[model samples]
Target chain A: MAATYELIYWPGAPGRGEHIRLALEEAGASYSDTARLDAQKCADIVWAQMSDNNLGDKNTSPPYAPPILKDGDLLISQTPNILMYLGQRLGLVPSTPEENDIYKINALVLTALDGLSNEVHDCHHPIAKELYYEEQKTEALRRSKEFIKTRLPKFLAYFEKVLKGEASGNGPWLYGGTFTYADLVLFQICLFQPQTDSQNLASSVYRKRDGVREKS
Target chain B: MAATYELIYWPGAPGRGEHIRLALEEAGASYSDTARLDAQKCADIVWAQMSDNNLGDKNTSPPYAPPILKDGDLLISQTPNILMYLGQRLGLVPSTPEENDIYKINALVLTALDGLSNEVHDCHHPIAKELYYEEQKTEALRRSKEFIKTRLPKFLAYFEKVLKGEASGNGPWLYGGTFTYADLVLFQICLFQPQTDSQNLASSVYRKRDGVREKS
Candidate 1:
């Protein structure tokens, strides 16, 4: 049987792929993890897919990096875009355009990806992605402190508010009454070891969410 | 007459709003820039909108930051999300789902925003967004070096390759043979001072693209 999705990312690290993984798990979509199967070959495929001379005319534009998803003829990247596409396909998002919940849910997903995940990555590589985390540890300390003290709390609190808002309908979900890809993404971010009292509080709330806790 | 769009972003710096602004310019869409009217009041509005108690029950979720767009009762944020919504309404994207160009264009737009804009912002705020540039200048210099020497070249060359791809159709647009929100976004990013040879080449190529140059 053919796989419903093929996820490519750097092996051994959940990183951004965790978000995609959670969505697939929640949707019960059958998928393949390329990196887990063969890390070396997966790296080669990612390199080639990003190169100017990719295998075929499958994609109009090549992705800049990994966390690429292959669904038959379609090969796409960008975490938010991938999740949005997959969310719609897997019924993780509302089917009706009129529902309007999908767009707002996507905005929340983008915030999680951009504000939470990306900034967390920057804490380790504050100077540059190419630089070793050890080389940038001093900068990383400062960044991580700010992230723990301010940025993390700010985003987590905002999400807490979203969970409590009228639009949430009940507890925990970022929008509507059901579990969304946004919730999945946020749950993954909150899983990182809590560095402060606020983050610990946020993680406990995340743990209490039925939808978020179910897959975890 | 009612405004078709209302853009809320910080005054003075174009920042990410420039991408949306370019799309609006190319589409000839009438829009309002709130910060331009009254910076202080506009900021207050943004603050309130971000808070748990926003003005109304219109938005399903309030944006974490500005660069929010208001259209009728809908409030949306995230640069790519707003642009995609506008691109569809403005006919900037190929309307037919059969075209399959929208997804590719959106992927390209996401690349430009995430890799280019986000990294550029990191150059100044290497440690933390809350910290002043002066506070982070040393780390900023290290990041700027990596950005100028490596990251910028990689993204520009990737776009340069995209422009020259079979999908680009003889010239500069990233997709579908005409100006797209992706092209508008790439063109805007290139408008920044060219800090490296790759960027200079990319900017010059962007300048020569007829579709991109028309509105300029």
Candidate 2:
């Protein structure tokens, strides 16, 4: 019997947890999105897991934040780490592990997360993650402007390079002509992108990617 | 005779590249720190590799930034991914390949980098990573204060939990009492921390962890 996975993350719009959820859905794996459950029934699950009472945590792997997963007794956290674990198990990555193509796929995953996901996150909360967006609006606006102008395009151009390469086989995929978990990661990241920048396909940096014109 | 690994990163005080360098040094592996060379002799190395000519990079893996490495024909980027590769080859990770402890180790590495290394980078550049510190001094100062008050202690307290746990073997080591690449990563991050907090280990979060007094 396949073990049912339980995913723990904040209940809200798709964040990093969306990357893991997309991989699981693509693989048709059994899983539970724990934080999405009814608030009355599962309110403490998040606080319990990220419990501030670190003094009592004797467990081998207590996660620092959410987007954590449990597979039987084993617990894992970190968006890329969780995706890598599921990638190896659910046929989302290349089967030939000995060749080390997995690490290459993982490099692509880290880039998308750092360049797109995390950067956009920081733009919204430039001063402090603990404080709300209202508390940091002035700094957030400046950071967001810089992100749209500089950082976003740098990453989009890099993805354009990957999309154009022979390794990606000339269309949508990010690596080696396969629909690896990296493709899922890129797909998830595109959802949160500033719509205005990403939509103007002909004028945007993504114009250089080969299949964009044909698809449009 | 062993093949010497080639590392490509900027010439400056230890940054993310130090994580990889420390791992290589600890494993006693042969490698070259490309940017550490004399100015004219290797001035173009960093620019050439992170070159803006994205369309021409048809290789299987073109790195987005430096601390990239060329291991024969393979080029791996991303700090944690590079560490994982070296950890596997140089015995910096646990030897068991099938058990998946490597991911557990990687989760620790990511937590330290995100919570410490990347946070500090943001403290210096809250508005724009490309802009000088003087251009963003007001915002940077505000962010740094929040970092000292909230983010740093949150991560340190988490590490304190890890150190107190049996998984860390009741001491300084991060996982299984074995010195893996993650240890090297933590050591590098500690260099950039605000000095006063970490030094007064007695009154700070480190007090909760078991072994600091014995060692100091």
Candidate 3:
């Protein structure tokens, strides 16, 4: 699809980029997912962007990894950072300089990325980011058990609590009465398939989302 | 130290909180470090805040972890989120809503926190955050080796390039000709001991900082 915003990411299970795509889709903003390219080509483009020679110029700082978002003269990286930029521009968040809600929403988003995404990622990778899952399976299994026992429920309960907050109103939203990128982020990552065996916890949160539309 | 801001974090080797301390010090913002309290009281307070009963209210979302910063009625957690909040209120970053520098600066700060802080942190606690360092010593050593070999040099090279960017203006600052929180952040985390064996890479970057004052 043609888009005014070009998202440069590996066209695979790029969950970090998927978080951005969720925000973009909700905003109905234009952005190509690079889905037209073959797998190898998508990987190549991701590597090429990280090449030192093409590292950003004076105004632009080079992005260390993928899921980069380019908007005209401005190029941004880092998932939360891109989300913040998009959140401000796309009405996924309020833009007024005096509002403190932007930071609150970003805080919840960062917590999700760390607990739900990064921690879960390390459970599989355990020892190394470059190593394959098979190489770390033993450690991965052990880590996964711990994750299910603690981290997963901890974060989900935290989000569940947020939805129950007085500001969250009747149900389902992560912040205030309106939907923001933080809500979209929780749905896209932690809620979808919900890497958990505690069906009770997952089902309870799922019911809350009945108040809001959710997409896989 | 009486200050307008109150930082609630465990008073120990709270390196994450130290990141905030660096920015506050550089900006000269007043915030008590909670050093006056005994260690037992310190640990109790940290756990108490995380208790679900105190998670947050209508306007506030409870923080999942510490290094939380409170500015009057506003409460923020997550290192980068806190940094972004402080960056705007203090002069660590440009406050103008129209300027993109805020995001650019934030992007760099997040990258540093991930690569330098989070990744390095995982090297020690590869299996679980709650696992003792001694328990994970073997994996920690293995992870540390990989970090020293690849991640360390890669991130430092990335920062060195940032310092070399034309906008960096032939000096040590991470962005533009100014010494914002980004520079202080680099100094506080990566440069303090710079968990790397590449003396040549480390020294080259250290020499550039001769143009700027560095603290331990």
Best by TM-score: 1
Error of 2 at A2 (Å): 8.5
Docking class of 3: medium
Score chain A of each prediction against the true chain A by TM-score and list the results. Answer: 0.89, 0.85, 0.89
TM-score: which is higher, 1 or 2?
Answer: 1
The best-first sequence of candidates by TM-score reads 1, 3, 2
Superposed model 3: Cα runs more than 4 Å off: A94-98, A194-199, A202-204, A208-216, B94-98, B194-197, B202-204, B208-216
- Tell me the tens digit of each residue's lDDT in model 3 across B1-216: 457898888876857988888788778888876644898887788888788777477688778888988888888888888988888788876444438888888888888888888898888888787778898787789789888887878888888777766756566677766767777677766456743468466564566445445433
* Candidate 1 Cα lDDT to native: 0.76
Candidate 2 docks at the CAPRI level of medium
Alpha-carbon RMSD to native, per candidate:
2.4, 3.9, 2.7
Candidate 2 residues lying further than 4 Å off, grouped into runs, are A1-3, A54-59, A95-98, A192-216, B1-3, B54-59, B95-98, B192-216
Error of 2 at A122 (Å): 1.0
DockQ top scorer:
3
Q: What TM-score goes with each of the models?
A: 0.93, 0.89, 0.92
Work out how many backbone clashes candidate 3 has.
Answer: 1
User: What digit string (tens of lDDT, one per residue) describes model 2 on residues A1-216?
Assistant: 554999888775578888888888888899988657886455478788778664323345578888888898788889999999999899987665547687788888999899889988999999999999999999999999888888877788788766766666565666666668887777666644444745453232333233322422
lDDT of 1 by residue, A113-211 (tens): 877888888888988888888898998998898888879888877777666666765555667666667778877876665445666646534653445
For model 2 chain B, where is the 10-residue window of minimal lDDT? B207-216
